[model samples]
Structures are given as structure tokens and as C-alpha cells.
Target: MELIERIRLHAARSPDSTALEWPGGTIGYAGLAAEIERLAAELRGRGISTLAISLGNGPAWAMLDLAALHAGLCLVPLPPFFSEGQMRHALKLSGAQALVTDQAVVLRERLDLPEPMGSWRVAGRPLSWIDLPGDPQAVPAGVRKLTFTSGTTGEPKGVMLGWNHMEPVVRSLADAAGVTPSDRHLVLTPLSVLLENIAGIYTALWSGATAIVPGCPEVGLIGSSRLDTAAMTLALDRFRATSAIFSPQTLQGLVEAIESGLPRPAAFRFGAVGGAPVPPRLLERAAALELPVYEGYGLSECASVVCLNTPGHNRPGSTGRPLPHVRLRIAADGEVLIAGPGFTGYLGEEPPAGEWWASGDIGRLDPDGFLHLEGRRRNVFITTFGRNLAPEWVEGELTLEPAIAQAALFGEGRPWNTAVVVPAPGADATAVAAAIARSNLNLPDYAQVSRWIAAEGPFTPANGQLTGTGRVRRAAVQGHYQQQIERLYQ
Candidate 1:
């Protein structure tokens, strides 16, 4: 319970249903529980406590994130692709005493923040308020959602969590994706991360459904690693979206716009891809274009789904099985641990020293329990003839070759493996060297690659080489291709 008592139990059992949708209106569930108890009573009459929500995906950023969990305050969520020194190191390491933005003169001329300590109009937009001088700190008594960590491979830590560790992972992801109220979901990413704010608006308002939220250019999300796919397939056919959530590069541009003919949304049912590592030939070309997608797995220290692949229980390359309140294990050097009830520690660090949660991700599980993963134990590497590999398993088999739109790999001690690629758009260089010789004939021979080059661009998140949840910030793409990876190792 308590996602503000499940939005006042869906405003006492569906008060006029709808519960949020955007491009200018639709609020219901008793006007989203009276605009989250009137902006959590105008943020507990301005004493605020910790707030921070930098706004973007509409409906007043889901009514001030459930009115900062109904005004017990503490929120944080900034991430509009961070970087103004990670939003002034997350408003001075989360000491944030009040921010609630909507750009506000580009965060008051880039983080000088201060001025207006008042302004609001809630769901009809506007917003403002600054305050922020500091001296708040002390957050760790069931800290209610601090978030942060999408810094790809650098600074962005925070984590925290609470609401009894994120309402049992949003009631085990609405009972492993069977979420109903006829699931209209569709806020494809950025409700300030935490996997689209607890698996896309707390599992679409814990199954009373209808989330939608718009803006990120009405779902084509232009910035952090571009995406348009015909304005995200006309915002999933103008919100006929029956469930959404993606990031395996926007489910590889909506499975290459449903293999070029574009037109998947016949009330789309369940999408859910994950933040990274999803290439079983892009889930076999999104199941040969039937495009139901699936593929899940998480981290934000487990509060955002801890394994999923739903819809008649999927498994096309694992990362499913484990959501019934999560518990998965594996260690014995294969890492991926995770013991249940959603993790609850990490703002200034210290708290997780055991009872599983090691998850520096490297996976296994199987024997019908699914899971799989296999990468990021500090991204493996080690070659100089000793072998070892796992550059996301050779860049997920060189992006399952639709003329490889990205690949990174590099051999940590050298002796064979190179890559940089990027292609896919009139591809060439003989179709990216024949898709790296058909991805080195299915890798091995010390994780193959041998030599490659092509990428003088496209590894995005505005060029820090990806990671506003698109992953590959591999030391900023090996320091922006250190002289074409030292001329492919001379």
C-alpha cells in the first residue's frame, strides 16, 4: 500500500476512471485524487522538506510525483538528461529543499537557482518555485525515492528508495504484467527514470491504467540518443497504447518501424524492453514483426522491476522470471544476486553489505527460472591471449546486424578484438565490412572482432557516447575513439 495509499485506492474505487493522459487533458480517478490532495496541500504548506522534481513528461509530472508521496516529501527526480554538472550534483547531493521546475529560466541561468519560492497551477502546467540553499541532508529512514544513477558509466549515484521499498516493486509489476483496467500505459521513458518512474507510472497507477503523459516531443524523445520512428509511431497511434516502456534503443526504433511498413499498434499490448543488453536479434526482429517486445531486467537497485518478460511468460533470451517480489540468485562469481523486498540503501552510501544485492550484473539462473544477462562485472575484457571477453557479449553480436547501428568492443589487454562501428542508415563500408564478417561468424576465437573502425559519430546521449539509458558510455566510447582506437592497434 501507500503510493499514497494507491492513490487513495484509485480515488475510492475508480472515481470516473481515466487517471491521467496528456497532450492537454484527461485526469479522473477523482481528478487524480484531487490533484494529489491539492499538490500535497501545496507541498505541506511550503515547509517542503526535500521536493526537487524538474518536470517534463506531463500531467504536472504525474501530479508532483504523487504529490511527493502525499507530502511526506523527499522526492528528487531531476534527470531531463542531466548535465549542468549533473544538475548541480543533484541539487547539491540531494540536500534539495525545494525545486519543482519547468525549466524556470533554464534552471535559473544554469543552476544559480534561487529566485521564486512560489508559483503553481499544477496540472494546467506553469509550476516554478526555487528555494534551494542547502542544509537538508540526513536522508535514510526509509528514504522515499532519491533515484539518479543513469550516468551511463560515471557520476550519477543516489539510489535510496522506500515506500516499503517501492510498493513491492509495484505489486510485482502488476502481477508480472497482467496489469489491467485495460492497460493503456504509454509514457515511453523519462518520468524521471527509475525505469519510467517505477515501471512506468507505478505500473500504470497500479492497474487502474490510463497513464499516457506525453511530451518528450510527444513521444519521439529527440535528445538523449535520438528517436523519431515517425514520431514514435504517431505516439503509439495517438495513445491507443495498451502498455509501453522501452529503452533497448526504443525497442530498436520500434523494431525498425515494424520492419518499414510501420503500423504495429492495433492496441499494442505489453512492450517493456529494458535499459540495455537486448539483442537476440532484437528479440528475433520483435518476433518477426508481430512486435510484442517483452525483454526485461532491472536496477536502480531493484526497485524498478527485477526481471520481467511477461505476456504468457516470455523467455526469448532470458531476463524474465523473478518478479513475484523478486529473489533471484547466482553468485559463485557469476554475480547477479538480488534477494527480495526491494533494496533500501545508497544515498551517501553504506547499507547493502549482504543478504544479496551484489548485482554488478553478470547472470545465469536458467533451469527454467530464466534471467541470463552475462555482462558488466565491470564489463569483463582481459584478452592478451588469456581470452575472457563480454564486451556486452561482443557488442551483442555486433548489434544483430541490420547493418549494425552501433557496436563498441575493444580488447582490454589486446591481442585481437577492435570494433567501433555505428552504421545503419544507408549502411556501407561494404555494409559495415559485411556486418563485421557476419559478426565474426558468431564470436569466439577470443571473442572475435579482430579489427574494425567506421564510427566517427552516432553513439549519442548528446555525444558523450550514449547513456541516458541507452548504455554504451564505455569510458566515453574509449575516449572518443582514441585516434581511431590507435589505428586499430597500429
Candidate 2:
């Protein structure tokens, strides 16, 4: 539960062993822990007992985050891609005055940042004076990190993750995923998502595995300096990476790596996917390609994972069974409800106006006892043809390939589904569409994507298409492609 203690233990046990990796590079436990202590001392002189981090996936970002904990400052990760509009909203909402960010443009263009300390820039320029001082100390028992629930109606609600909330969940996953001290596991998702924090960081480091952060922007998200196929392959090769956690989107990159003749490390042993429902087709291709991908499910409230399919216990379409300590129930309406370690709902919000948490997701368990997630209650749509549909069902099937990076299917009052997709960087539109067509062969006519369009670019969070948790804003997606949808139908 003590942040500094965990790092100290890792540092003492294997001072020379690599503890974590980022796009800018790797850090040995001794060095990282030392830096945390040094950074803590620097922060202490500034009289700041709290920190708000606004960086992305890399060594610097992770260092700032973990160092803040060791420094005993209440930590808050400012989702790096929030628009000025959203940033101001979050700032006002959280009352965070000090921030550490990687955005040069925001500083140069906006002209509104706290007083500059020394000199700083993201991509280049200068940010608010960058001199701060603090000493690393054990965080007291209370709120540690404030993670937000992506907006449902309007302003996002902040969820306070008490210091101990993630320790158990991270440990459970490390146990379930078979993480070991010698392994080097790639950290893929953005920091805003709990998956990367719990499964990617805590679990990997807890098991004494080297948590590798890609040094490039492409390896993790659209523009991440720490991630890319080549970087991932090189890191896996260079570090002898043993495992990873990915979303379906991230797995698509793995498919590309295979196709590009990027060698999959024989040491690579485990991988699991979630964030959204993963199609069976995607799993099949991942398996065939030797990526060892397994599908799973979780939410931010659960601190990342509750149920996951592991190597030998794999189920293709299901999210798989819950971890031993998690209990699950399917409400009469078919929504999945869970009670387990690691979960605490939004801090300021009342639990649905009363007691038990009602996940807005609708799902059911098969008679065979495996869990099957249906669509989100807010997302199910009835078509113009009077056919009710789960858009994610069709969209998930389309994203099974190495080409489709993102997809959205909507046609609430239309005869059939209309999909708007973003293809992988260089994939041809016609070819990608054909692949989707081929994948849809088994779906009923009503459920099939009757028309589809591909965009040349992927959506960015700044444009408001993605949430901090990396979920698509379906309405924003639909609105962005409105004219294109009309063109497809006509």
C-alpha cells in the first residue's frame, strides 16, 4: 500500500535489473527509485503536496506519475489529449493548479499556464516556468489518484482511487497472467486507461517483470512517441519481452507486425485483449499468427480486469470467467453486475440514486456458465427496418483485420447498418472494405453492415472522438460521418 515501499523493495531486490521501459527508453529499478526520491525532494521545496500529470505514454510520463506517489503528492493524470475546452473544464472541476504536460502548442497558443519555473517545452517552445521541489515520502491512507469517468451526459465525474484500490487487482492479474520476474512486458495503452496502469504497470512490476514502454509515439496510440510495430518488435526482441496486454485495436497492429515479417519473439508467452468486445474472428487470426491473444473484460471502476480468458482456458467470443475473488450476476434485464476487490464507483456520484452498482452494460452468462456481454444499454439501437441491433456486434467483426483501426455502426432509423471506419495507416480502402465484406458472411442480413465508408485518418481525442478510457464517443463518431452516411445510403 505504501508507494515508496514497493519501489524500494524492487530496488533492493534487484538493483541492476531493468524495472520498466518507455518509448524514450528503459529504467533500472535502482535508478527509477532514486529518481523518485530525488524528484520527491525537489517537489517538497515547492510546498506542493499534490501533482497533476498531463503527459502521455513514455518514461517521463510514468516517472512523473510514480514519482508523485513516492513524493506523497495526491496524483492526478490530466488526460493528455483533452481539448482546450475539456482541459479547462477538468482544471476547473479538479481545481488542479499545477500540471506537468508534453503539449507545446497548448502553452504557445493558449498563452495561459501557471507561472514558468525555469524553462520547458513539449515538442518544443516553452511552458510555464518548470522549477518545482519535493521530497519522496509514503502517501498517507486516503485518495491517491483521481481518475475520471468519461462523460455520460456532460461534465466528466472524478473517481478517487484510494491508494490500495489497485494493489489487489494488479496482483491478481499478475498471478492470472503468469507474470514472472524475468519477463519484459510491453505497456501499450494510454495512462488514462486503468488497463495500462493495473495490468501494464503495477502487475508487470509487481511480478518483477521489466515493464517496457515503447520509446516512440506510434507503439501505444495514434501519435504516441513510445509505440509502433517496429518499436514493439525491436523492444520485444531487445528486451526479450515475454508478455503484453492489448485492446482489439492494439492487436490489429500485432497482425501487421506478423504480416510485415516482424519476428514474434519465441519468449513471448501471454497477451490479453479488452476495453471493448473483441470479435471471435480477431481472436482466431491472433491465435493463428502466434500472438497468444486472449479476450477479457473489465471497467475503470473495477481497476481494469475482473474476468479474462487465459491461455488454456480460452473462449473465443466470451469475455471469459472472472478471477477467483470476483462475483458476477446477470440482472433480469441481462446487465452484468460485479462485486469484487479493486472496485469503487465514482466518488462524488451516488450509486444510481441508491445502493448496488448497476453497470449500464447489458449481458448474460451462457448456460455453460461463461460470461457473454451484450451491448451497453445506452448503445443498443433499433433500425428503420424495425430490426433491433447491437452496433458493436457488427463493428467488432469488422475490426478483426490488420487494417481496420476503428469502426462505428449506426442506422437507428435506416434500413440497414452504416459503418464509418478508419483504416490502418497504409491499407487501401477498397481492400479493407472487401475484408469487412468477407468477414460479415455469417451475420444475418439485418445485422450486416449494408454500407460502409473509410476515413483517411484516425480520430484523435482532441477532436473529441475518444474518451480518457479509450472508448469511442459513438454520437461524436456518428456526427463526424453524418454526410458520408447519407452518401452511402443514397
Candidate 3:
């Protein structure tokens, strides 16, 4: 069933069941369905074809998203973490006709809009609605959602998805994770992230579960990468969240918090970890703490999650089997490929060429059919000896040690790999070296980090060294540390 259909069914079956929960209020299934209908009618009356939202995560965000879907308007979700340039690029590229945001004052100054077109209370939160000068750029007829990606470099690209591409993933995910009406899914990452929006919120709603969507600040998410584990855990406990999605970095912080005497949310289960390659050691630690994390793999072009590890079938280091909606295969060159109708293509661009979308990731299916990812196909570097290496594989091992917070290995056409290491807070050289030595134990001599330099600080979006979704921007990091790396080689 479609998302809106599922909401209507839930409202009819269990009108009083909580469908959405936030800091100040809760909306039951009946209220949620009714509210979405009203909002959809309002958007239709205003003649909105494309709607963009920059609101913080909460009931308002949820309601507006559903309203856009119901009203047949293309929804463009702009992540607040995006820079002004990126935000402007998305708004223009997607040809957004209307914008709904809580930070109206700041966005007005940055986006250079005149006074607000109007203001209204949506889902109990006061918000501003502005009319944008729609761009003439064609976004394609079938596109229903345009999600801009915080890719490795350059301006963010808008990946468009239609209802057909998204619904299967939602239903498959709900089935894979075994979501039910009793489950409460906490929205940990930004809803603009397709993974959290489709796989997290949409899946929960499809399963008739309540979605707990506190603002990023309420969950202690300072930006794209920095998180306060204590605050996040408190929210989990407060809402009694049964499920949530996380990137590897956030999961590591939560594990450290639990180790530092903060009680783990006992109700927490089905933690889906992705957005980057997860260190096996980190997964082991989380498992040791009984955190119930499952690693998955996806790309925005594939409609968020292509494959996921579920409770019934999971492998620790592998990214798991493909979900039912799509078929996955390894190309002759070892690139992962997904077969389906694919996306509606990037905004203002021609439709994607092939029937199979090249994932750019290199991985293989195990004997038992589990997909084990090595790293990005383009990211693989060749050493002077002509041996190929995937830096993410080595970096994953390095981050396994608690002393090392982030690692970027460089050895392209060089004799040996050199890592720019970001040590955890208060970790001295000795601690970092020890961590590297321990990680080297798990790698072959050819792939070991023969020499390393301490980074000034963690690789983050602010520094242009990390993507919004936590993937390391290898080129940016190498450029920043070129001189130091050369010194180590000399």
C-alpha cells in the first residue's frame, strides 16, 4: 500500500494510536491523517507544484512531507546543514515554487526573498510560507521528490525519485526490519537525508508505527557530524524508541557513552547503521553492549536503501543481501549494479541512461549471498608496486581503535600508504601510534599505514574534508595535507 493509504488504514484501525511524537505534543493516527488532508488541500489551493522545506525535524516536518505527497507536488527537502551556496543551488535547480521553513528570517536574508507570502500554524508549530520565483529548469514530469546529495565534491546534486521508486523501498524495509504498530522509531539523522526520510520515517508509517521526530538540537545533533550521545540517549529513553537509524560515527559515540556509565535505552532495538563503511570492531563493540545495530548499504540514486541486514538474516562485516524491490549484481569490473526503473534522474539533467544503475561501489556477494563491500571503485588506489588497495578497508581498521577518531589513507603511486590521523580527544602521539600498530596487525604488509601524521582536527564538513553523510572527501583531505604527507615520504 502507498504511504497515505497506510496512514488512512492506521487511523481507521487504531484512531487513538500515536502516529507522531515530538517534544511538546503527540498526534494520533486519526489526527495525523486528517491534518495531512487539510494541508494538502491548502497547498493545492495555493497552486503549488514544487514545495521545498527547511524546517527542523518534528511533527510539522512529517505533516508537510505527507501533505506534499498527497497534493501531488514535488517535495524538495533542504538540509539545514547545507551551506548557503548548496541551498541556493537546490532551490534553483529543482525549480521550487514554494518554500516552508521555520528559520524564515535567516533564509530570507540568505535567499534574498522579499517579505513572506504568508504564515500559518502547521502541526502546532508557527511557520512561514514564501512564494519562490520558480526557475524554468525542467525537473521532469514523473519526479515527485528531489533530494540533493552532499556528494564527495562540488555542488550537491539533486537526485529525483517518483512514488514508484520510493514505495517499494519503504515496504521492503518495513518488512525487512519487521516494523509493526507497536514499534516507535526515533528520527536520529536529518529527515532531509533520504535514508532517514524513506527508510526511517516512511517505513515506520507503512508499518503503522509511531514516528518520534524531535528537532536536531533536541537530539543533540550540532550539525551534520557532531552529536551529543548523552542527549540522544535521553531522547531515546524519553520516547522509549524501539528503532532508529545511525551513521557509524554516531553509533560509536553512543557506545562510548554507554561505556562511560550512561545507561543504554533498554527499549532501543533495530539500529540501522549506514552512510559509510562501518568498522567491524565498532559493530562488535555495539553488539557487546547489546545495542542491536544492523549494517546496510545504499546510494541516493537507488532510492536510499538497496540492501539491508535484518535480525533474521545478518552478517557482521557484510552489508547484507539486496532488498526484495531490486536485484543486485557485480559487474565484470567488480562494480555493484542495481536493476530497476531507477530514479527520475538528477534535476535539470537528462534521464539516467542504463536500465541498471552503476553504484560506483566495488563489492561481491558471498557464498551465502551476502554482499560484502570493499570500498568505492574510484577510490581504490594503486601503490608503486602496482598493488591496488581500498583505503576505506584500511581506514575502517584504523578507526576500530578508540584512540583514532578518523583516518584517511593515501598511497596512490607511492611506495607505502600514509594516513592523516585524527586522534580522539586527549589522545597523545603514543596512543595514536599504538592504535595504528594494533590496526596494522589486521592488514597485509602492502596495505599497512607505514607512516602517519596527526591531523589538526577531525575531518568534518566545516573543513571540507567530509561529506554531509559522513563519507570522507579523499581529494579534499589529501589536498589539505599534501605538504605534511610529502614530508613524511621524504
The lDDT for every candidate, in the order shown, is 0.81, 0.69, 0.89
TM-score of 2: 0.85
User: What lDDT score is found at residue 359 in candidate 1?
Assistant: 75
Better of 1 and 3 by lDDT: 3
**After best superposition, candidate 1 residue 261: deviation in angstroms?**
27
Q: Highest TM-score among the candidates is held by which one? A: 3
Model 2 regions lying over 4 Å from their true place? 22-27, 102-105, 119-141, 150-153, 218-228, 341-348, 351-355, 367-369, 384-386, 401-405, 423-433, 453-457, 468-470, 483-490
**Model 3, range 119-227, lDDT digits (tens) per residue?**
8899778999888888634577767889998888788889999999999889889899999999999999889889999988889988889999998989879876678
List the candidates' TM-scores in order: 0.35, 0.85, 0.97
Give the number of the best model, judged by lDDT.
Answer: 3
Candidate 1 lDDT (Cα, 0 to 1): 0.81
Over 410-488, each residue of candidate 1 has an lDDT whose tens digit, in order, gives 8899988888888888988988888888888987688888788888778876566776787888888888778879887
Tell me how far the alpha carbon of residue 323 in candidate 1 is from the true structure, in angstroms, after superposition.
Answer: 33
TM-score of 1: 0.35
lDDT tens digits by residue: candidate 2, 1-490: 5656776788898887888765455678888788777767766666665566666566666666676666666776766566666666555555554666666446535636655555444222243433223332322336567666664335666665665677777767877888878888877667766678768877776777788775335453455212366665555566666787776666766776776888876788888888877778777777788777788888777666878888867777888888875778888877788776544445445533433456678888777667888788888888877887887788777777557777788888888887888886678878787877876796888888777788646656666776654567788887778888888778
